[model samples]
Target: MKFIGRTVVLLLIVNILLVYMHYKQAGDVIAKDSGTPTYQQEIEVMNRSDALYIRHHFSGLSQGRHEIIWPEASADRSCYALDAISCGRLDASLTAFVDGDNEKQSISYKIPKENSESQAMLYHEPFVTLQGATVTSTLFHITDETRSGGMWVNGLEQVGSKQMDLIDYTFFQGSGGVQDLYWQQNSLPLVYEGEKLAVYGPAGHTEQFEAVDAALKTIGADHSAIVIDQTSIAVQSQRFIVSENADIDKASTLFLTSAMAARYSIPQQERLLVEVVASILGDKAIGAEQSRQAYDKLIVALTPEELALLKEVVNSKAGQEMNATILDDLIKEVTGFKTSYFKTAIQKDTADHLFLFEDTREVRVDGTSYADIGIVLKDGKSLYPAKSILSHLGYTVTANEQSLYIEKEGRKFRFPRKEPFYVYNERKFDVRTSPFEVLSDEVYFEESWFRRLFLLTIDKTAETIDIVNLSTVLEEVIE
Candidate 1:
């Protein structure tokens, strides 16, 4: 019996040793050695303020690059409203890897309901890197605001081969909802001035291409563009150049030569191309009819020869067939024009605040319009009535003593009266104009609120306000 007991004890000891060895091996592979330099830092922003919590881990080193995995479970969130407490949660899953050389990086992330089809991937290997480029960002503004509060880092820390910089943007907004964590890397040159694409179009059509290019540039994109003559166009093996040789698979803009566009089967690939361009431009690209109209304006300005060529290309038998059926499809694919189907142009009443919603519904608010069909307070800042606009946008609005809440689909927006800021999905942001105010039993909010919260595009000269739901647009983009 004593021998049996000793045998059992020895067996237990062996199992314990085996488990410890396995864990030790895993630890070595996962992290690095104790001497490995591991540090962390965080930047927090509350519309602008900060708080940082960091920890460093050093274990035994292994082969391959280090992987940074994000939390997959729903994170708890809390907010205060009207002396009451509210709770909500948001789910996200993201992973990133910084190559051992520290010069390359890749990220894969899923944005819960915002994106579900597949994970988005971004890989960077220093495109146009400045030799001594610093990673400057609006995050520095956050650091400046929080420094006096003693919640910011006064020093820097480098982890592994890559540096650790965590930016936390907290919207000190009103009541409970999901918060958007926006991380924009403004490190590249011309990050703010914008990027441009070299446009290659049919020969002798510089004025035609220049018109469209200038319009896009005025909207803060495709800046300093070069309109190249297609016949003698120089093809640089690069990204973002709109030319015949451009890889459509990777290129965002496609410049369809007259011949190539003619070869497209009516109502099929041509429509697809328009859709692709609209998806790429997101908010900037206009619809087919609008594009056609813009093209018409450009043609009117074209020289006799250029105009003649355009008419020839457009009035050809192939163009006739495409224009008859496929033109509508192409126009339907534009991102921001809700009035594409309307035959008549929306007339702008600049004197009064008259807004044509989708060129179908017209609303003449008592207040003046600023920044176009949006709203402007009599005080010179922009503001709008929540019920008047939200009702038109298919949103259900509820009224309370202290605030007005508007909801559409699964999204919610809260505008609190007398507050300097408003909350969307639980995150807060500062409002240039007062978010909500009660005048004669109506709730009023800033004109920019709807645009900022709902992602709706407002066009002043066109006198049109796009009410198309952005989520629906995104779903279409996904499809």
Candidate 2:
């Protein structure tokens, strides 16, 4: 009887063990089908997903050059927020992704919810709001769901490279819940000023090409741009002479790089082409719609008298063209604006005595500074100097029939209003009232540039401006 009882106990133990194994296999199947990971299967999908951004400390990007930046997340960002800037103050989310060996063992992580775009001085971590499975719930559900990319080796890190052209990649912008999208070209051709250009979209459709039309419109290329089919982009410009054999692939690089660098690789010749184009096209490169809006915003930033004075300046040939040239150069040289996008790199002034204006990016200095930089506003056919803008900041801006003059901070500047006008730099310039130009009555500096070019022309002492002290300038106007 004792032997029989012992045997029965052993059989029961074996039966229980077999049942456990069978259920474990069943659980695995269910997890796969339900899209829910079992306790051990979470990492399996991760390894399979090939989330390449894991290699980066900033949001790991999966493809085309990603401009992933570190973050400084905050809750009350209103104090430092600007409409042009999408990001505000914040702490670091400090997000991370680590690879592991287990296929079935699940590893968990929390993705940060905030997407900060405005550039700060340093790459700071964002604040993490959740952890574990809840972490995924709190973060955004953005995905390259198409899974349409192959791995591309970049730097020491390998990232997933999508087979997208630069146009499609840099055309759209993703902001919080809103998305801005545009079409793309398979291959694009670039036109540099002084070069003859042939414009076409897809299937060899050549319509209006070069800066012929873009230069005339006050708003610019994005709005008046001629696109061919769904693949080609033609941004009109007055700067370059186009070659009949201009290659589209090379030009595409110029447009792509000028628009977004991380998204495309441009050859040196193409870069030269962009510089030339930017030099001639100036602010007219921004779509007409955008320029109109910019003008409206800037008007709000100015005082009643300042706006009036600015209007007068924009009407002048020198004011219109010079400002357009300066504005476009600043955008391309600093913040890049292309077909439908704006990619800006915000850097703080390195000079110890310099600070950004509390309300804007314009630099300011305390004490006595010789140089006074005034942002020229576009008003009608004339370029307007905001006399009120200069006066409020303790500068005296005066304009006569033949010239625009200013004494601000400590520097003095004189701009010729009519033809045969030469900057202090003595470079030959054109004050053309071209019918096919953005500013019909404005003067364009065919051979001159603002500060960057100005500095090259004029010899000057280095001085810093305090943007901090200028905060009051905006405080009085914004309200």
TM-scores for all candidates: the values are: 0.21, 0.17
**Candidate 1 structure quality by residue, lDDT tens digits, 1-479:** 54344333322222222222222232323333333333221223232222211111112212234444333322221121212211111112222222233332222122222322212111112111112111221111122222222111111111112122443222211111111222222111111111222222222222333344344344332122221222222222112221222232122222222222333333333443332222222212223444444344333333455444433333232313443233323332331222222122212211122111122223332222223232323344445656666666678889777877888876787777667787778889786766555643556655566566766654443543334445556777899
Prediction RMSDs, each to the true structure: 31.9, 27.8
lDDT of each: 0.32, 0.27
The segments of candidate 1 whose C-alpha lies over 4 angstroms from its true place after superposition are: 1-377, 380-382, 428-433, 475-479
Worst 10 residues of 1 by lDDT: 151-160
lDDT of 2 by residue, 1-479 (tens): 54344233322222222222222233334434555422210110111222211111112211122122222332221211223321211223323222322221111232222322211111123222111211111111212333333211000111122334421111111111111111121333322121211222223222323333333232211111222222223321112111112233234334432432111222332332222222222322222233334433433444555544443333222212232234334433332221111111111111111111111123343333323343223332212223423454565656567776555444565666555443433444453441111122223221123323222122223332232233454565698
Pick by TM-score: which candidate is best?
1
The 10-residue segment of model 2 with minimum total lDDT is: 150-159
What number of backbone clashes does candidate 1 have, counting pairs of residues 3 or more apart or in separate chains? 13
